[model samples]
Target: MDDKNSQTQTQINLVVAEPVIDIPTLTHRGPVKQRSPPPILARFHAGYFRISLSLCGQAFLWKTLGKPANDSFVIRRLLRLLPSTAFLLLWSIALFILMTLSLLYLLRCFFHFRMVKGEFLHHVGVNYLFAPWISWLLLLESAPFVSPKSVPYLVLWWAIVIPVVALDVKIYGQWFIKGKRFLSMVANPTSQLSVIGNLVGAKAAAEMGWKESALCMFSIGMAHYLVLFVTLYQRFSGRERIPATLRPVFFLFFATPSMASLAWESISGNFDTPSKMFFFLSLFMFMSLVIFFFF
Candidate 1:
């Protein structure tokens, strides 16, 4: 029995060490000796959630940060002179349309429970499930019509943040309870998204003046992030598991700290010392990545 368990562990290590990902065959199956693209990719999976997520984040930046960033003399003198809620509204409408279409596809049409089950079990794909909710929360935070302390706002926050907290339990619970064939073996940069999603939720909670809730969410995200950060930093597992095309996602390294700074700033009611440290760290990481690409 011990030998059998040892052999199973060895096979998992071999599968993870490979550079190529057989998305179709990521499920548990007997040795099939061949691989092909999963038809499911064309159908729909949580993996594609990242597409609209990227656009939603960009819109969030424009609406939530870019418009108000007129402290610079040039921006204040010229751009601030031109009032254009029109562009922001246009972007918001487009983002809403995209989110509607994407959610309709993911949830309305048959809702592939089997495929979702597979995604939950698959390490890389599972992490992406967080992207959709993260996108929605960012859009909500950026929505001009929503009053942060209003009843509807509170309801929507619960509707979105509850799922994130639930997923944290299921995923992080597994990380805590399972020592074999899990977390340490499969932790990847994508896992960082799960952390980011929680931080995003924390920021939203803080916006609504829910300080206790914000700290609770923030602690969960930062705790797991620290563990995963060290794991990926040391290349403890799943480092080579990513493909070259996905290397750009390493940018998320700095993004995590950037998001942390914003969340902490909101929680503390000031961009205080800890927030400054986080911001500086994010800047340093951004420059490090820039230099990395330069050479």
Candidate 2:
């Protein structure tokens, strides 16, 4: 009886046994499993994307209704409504959340500097440097609407913008000058972040009456933008390789030049010849994008 039971258990084990190796099939059938981004990267993915909100806020603030006003009860009430308040709230929340995430990200990188440097810092992490500063720009711009006389807010903006700008220098220096690895990473739209950050910084600086600093930042941004723009255009035009999910971000091609124009106008005090040229360039890019995307 014992021998019979033992034999039965062995037979059960054989019946349930799994293969130790995957057998190669003659035909491929299933969808391939896509590799996920690393944990450190995936955690701050949302932070990297806060630029979309910043851009939207900038457009609404600078282009559409103009800056928020608290001169009258009616205007203040209007600013408090869903549309205006929504933009302010969205911009504020995005900035704070990203700022916190950025601090955490930096702290983690401190401990795992080797792995981060070898992997993300050279790749995805470099692109993310723009998000925090862009958030800062949005926050700086928001001060007038939130509190017109908040000196502390302005002071904080100055403090934050310096380090953010320095971080950009370090990262871009590594990529463009030291590593010379920019060409290999040109496909992603987020690569435009450095230029966008500078242009936005120019706007912020100009608002603070730092015209010289604004011009310097804007010039550096525009100089690099021209090269990046042409390279990215050449890259994307040759291939329909971008995933459909990522197609919306191509709007950034229009955004960078638009922002450059706005920043130039801010610095020059008028939309003169150069400013108009930048504006027209942006308009053309926008129109081209619309036609291509819709048609």
lDDT of 2 by residue, 1-295 (tens): 9998887874334466643334344537755444333456434443344554555465346323444443555545555554656665666565566566666667656655665565445444456656666766665665535442367655766776686678667766765665335544434666677788888888877867788888888988888787777767675443324456656767888778877877888788776888888888879988998999899
Among all candidates shown, the one with the greatest lDDT = 1
Q: Give the TM-score of candidate 2.
A: 0.65
**10 residues in a row with least lDDT, candidate 1:** 18-27
List, residue by residue over 1-295, the lDDT tens digit for candidate 1: 9998887874334445663345333337654445433455446766666766777776666565444542665634564565568646656775776676566556623445666677788877778778888888887887767889899989999999888888888889888787753567877788899999999999999999999999999998999988888888775633337767678778889989999999999899877998999899999999999999987
Candidate 2, poorest ten consecutive residues by summed lDDT: 62-71
Clashing pairs in 2: none
**What number of backbone clashes does candidate 1 have, counting pairs of residues 3 or more apart or in separate chains?**
0
Please, what is the whole-model Cα lDDT of each candidate in the order they appear?
Answer: 0.78, 0.65
The candidate scoring highest on TM-score is 1
lDDT of 2: 0.65
Model 2: residues >4 Å from true position, as ranges? Answer: 1-43, 46-48, 51-64, 68-119, 145-154, 175-188, 236-245
